[model samples]
Target: MTAAPVRLTARALLLDMDGTLVNSDAVVERCFSRWAERNGLDPAEVLAVAHGRQGHATMALLLPDRPAELNLADNERILAEERADTEGVVPVPGAAAFLASLTGLPHALVTSADLPLARIRMTAAGLPMPSVLVTAESVGASKPDPEGFLKGAADLGFAPADCLAFEDSGAGIAAAKAAGVRVVGVGPRALPHHPDAHADTLTTVTVTAAPDGLLTVTVG
Candidate 1:
């Protein structure tokens, strides 16, 4: 028999933003595609590489030969636009309840999105802002590098092995695994490059509703 996906015995959860907790795929794709077109690059290539990476990191990969100042300027422009208009952005199915249930847990938002963009998206989605956010600006590297996830765990006062990660992209999964955290895949199973416990959405996660209004989430 195949072994059950590993679920860590931890008190903290590191949640990813985009596809994991929020359904911002459309907005992200539209924005990035426009950016790519303006830069004379393919939209597909930009989408593929930028899905779970910081904007600056994506710029570095997309325009590796460009000066850092140029990349920064572009990223800043993107952030301003995103923050100003995130109309279609919303939390993933059941994400609001899941996050509400995790009110007392030692969890934090660990996302590749930079601070301003992340906040704008979260606010637009009406999701409670996490106090301990490890944003793109907080890390030297983005997802697929493990730095973001690791930093989140550290900031939460837990080891990576003692944290559970909720991710939706291949890059995010790899980052969580690299950080030694057990992962629960929360979107298209085909997107993840690594093996992990799969769930159709946040609703699929088995959460026990406690009498005191707390939820004990279980990932299988």
Candidate 2:
């Protein structure tokens, strides 16, 4: 017998870009690894603290002795590198279809990547550009701080509790949860974060507009 699907209704959908809506793992790792090598830091350790956080924050963590201005400049250079390298970038499974289904819905992209890098990656993945994009530059802090997600919810004119957040990283999940948003975790990386719902990929979930003006999300 088939098990019943889980359903939730939300006034808006908030999504993380890399590793959630798009797959840019290769480019991300490559750029970060190169940056680490250039800075005499361990690539593995750098990457461990990098994902889902702003570039400047990662740089600050990795090089605490450095001046904040230098970290900011390094972040800008890394963003350019990421923007220039999109060879293996692609949409997450069913991401394109899922986004297409949200035509009339309130949705936004909240990413740690700076604006230019986010644009490059999304364009490479062939994903539709979000009408509302809250990038790293738009917030005072990154994921795990809840600033971006909170800003995203506000930009969509939805209360934090009324939004549904989709994320694939622990930092992102923490951010959403802290902002009082229910989260649908996108992949294995999100497991430890204990999101409200879990899916192997976007393909396993479906969205529909309800009569009561809510977006109904169904997960299998």
Candidate 3:
């Protein structure tokens, strides 16, 4: 027999960008691959830790001895490259419909992308930008630090425990969980993180808002 769908209730929703709503792996791979080769690091390994964290943070992890300032500068260049190269960026399956379902609901985009990068990717993906956003510049710390997710919950006027986060990376899931928000794992990348609910894609998830201001999210 098929298992019953998992249902989660929350006052607001927090969303991660890259792997969750937008599929920008093509650009990410191309940009990071070049950066990795330049630094004499393996592209695959860099990409492995690249998603869901600020570029600077990813650089720091791969090159621990590098000065923080250099990482920051590298992050700027990487963001520029990513922003200019939206060749393969597109919305994930059901992303448009999913966002439509959240109309008039309390939700925020909590992502490691800086504002410009986030805007371009969303545009390339043909997805609407959430009115409430907690991008990289909005927080001092990156994913796995809980800063962005915490700020997202606060921006939506909901306590962390009252929010549900949708993430597609281990770092993003960790950050949400650390901020006291239950997570809905999106895509294969999020599976190992073990979110409260798992969906292969947004196609398997649906959301509805109650008159009392609660959101019911169902993941099949």
| Best of the candidates, lDDT | 3
Q: Residue by residue across 7-31, what tens digits does model 3's lDDT show?
A: 9999999999999999999999999
On the 0 to 100 scale, the lDDT of residue 194 in model 2 is 93
RMSD of each: 3.4, 1.6, 0.8
* Model 1 pairs whose backbones collide: none
Number of colliding residue pairs in each model: 0, 0, 0
Please give, for residues 30-95, the per-residue lDDT of candidate 2 as tens digits: 999999999998999988878788888888877888999998998889888888899999999999
Clashing pairs in 2: none
Off by over 4 Å in 2: 1-4
lDDT of 2 at 193: 81
The sequence of per-residue lDDT tens digits that candidate 1 reaches over residues 109-217 is 9998888888888888899888899998898877789999999999998888878888888888889999898888888832456545677677767554446533355
Quote each prediction's TM-score.
Answer: 0.87, 0.94, 0.98
Candidate numbers sorted by lDDT from highest down? 3, 2, 1
TM-score of 2: 0.94
- Model 1: weakest 10-residue lDDT segment is 207-216
